[model samples]
Target: MAHRSASGSDRSPHPGRSLAGQLQHLDALRRAMARRHSLNPADMRLLWLLSDDRARTFREISEELNLEQSTVNRQVNSAARANLVQISDDQPARLVLATKEGIAAFDQDVDRSLNGYRQALERMGTEHTAEFNALLAEFIEAYRDIVQPDEEP
Candidate 1:
């Protein structure tokens, strides 16, 4: 009978490495799908931003995202052409608002993307699922702090 290696050092999957790879892969897939849907990641973000507010100006989005005005303007124009959003001249600011279809699309995409993660969690058992979420949440917080930092009220 053949015997397997009992040594713990042989070949074991590193949870950290696996999770990192999965996160990178998922992010890439999301970006690719966004492009395929005739929207970029920034466009999706713009949709989300406008979903709540009736409108916002290029300057507002630029400041919020820390992107240049020209870059944000171009993204808005592209989204506008796709009918995912509409821009209008308003008193407060140049209004940028998501169309009804755009809102629905964003909602659907979010559900679809999260569904896979939900399934994986279900299969991972309760204890592991909780641990995984905690780790992922920690990483998310760290990332947000790195990118956005602490903003004063």
Candidate 2:
């Protein structure tokens, strides 16, 4: 069986093209969110993590975000300087927590970014959106397994 191309040329989509396209879209969304919030991905992630009440040490954040400890530490320092995060040295181990301002900022960004997605889901209908989300989750899990086989079952 032979396939014809639109321009009468034998052309095939490249393997992993779809995944790359999806990643590009995700990156674009992240950049748009950053621009809208005036914060970078690292800053936003830190705020989001802290907003979730997941107070953790630098090491824990590094592992959870799959970012280098040094990079995470630097962002934490920057956030602290910006009054977006507070360092509690009174604790046995220093903990990072989102300050009131950080929470407020994060909430605004969430409403702007995440809520937009929520609205899109609502427009898509519950059942269709649920199925789409489920499939996206499966694809992400499979990608993780492929990228980090040692961490997979």
Candidate 3:
């Protein structure tokens, strides 16, 4: 059965064409980034999260990424093995922070990714890109409200 919106419309407010295309583009981007950086998507996400110089527990990462504890643990372990992250010896929970090398890698990856985006934006022109970004943000906010009606703005 097809899902109907609150307005009793058969059409979904969040159409698959827009959402799926965005997701597909993101996945492809991630794949290309992973190949270029020699890091898996999970590791990429972990590195990105830890790039801010803040220490985080595995639980925090798991919750923030909506990933399973075991999966987070595996990713953390892999990162540690790669010397990209350091795990503290705290009693109950081990705090994780990115190593200098990890930070460097993250910065390089970000530069490359941003350059790609900048090139695309340049092709699209500044005004149109700005308008698209604003509209995308608005769409996301509206969709979030629809999904979680009790969510605070």
Candidate 2 CA-lDDT value: 0.84
Residue-wise C-alpha lDDT for candidate 1, range 108-130, written one tens digit per residue: 77666678668878999999999
- In order, candidate lDDTs are 0.78, 0.84, 0.86
Q: What TM-score does model 1 achieve against the real structure?
A: 0.69
TM-score of 2: 0.72
Give the top-scoring candidate (TM-score).
Answer: 3
- List of clashing residue pairs for candidate 3: none
For candidate 2, write residues 49-142 as lDDT tens digits.
7777778888778888889988988999999999999988987878998899888887887788888788889999999999999999998899
Better of 2 and 3 by TM-score: 3
Who is ahead in lDDT, 1 or 3?
3
Which has the greatest lDDT?
3
State the weakest 10-residue window (summed lDDT) of model 1.
1-10
Query: What is the full ranking by TM-score, best candidate first?
Result: 3, 2, 1
**TM-score against truth, every candidate:** 0.69, 0.72, 0.77
Q: Cα lDDT for residue 107, model 3? A: 79
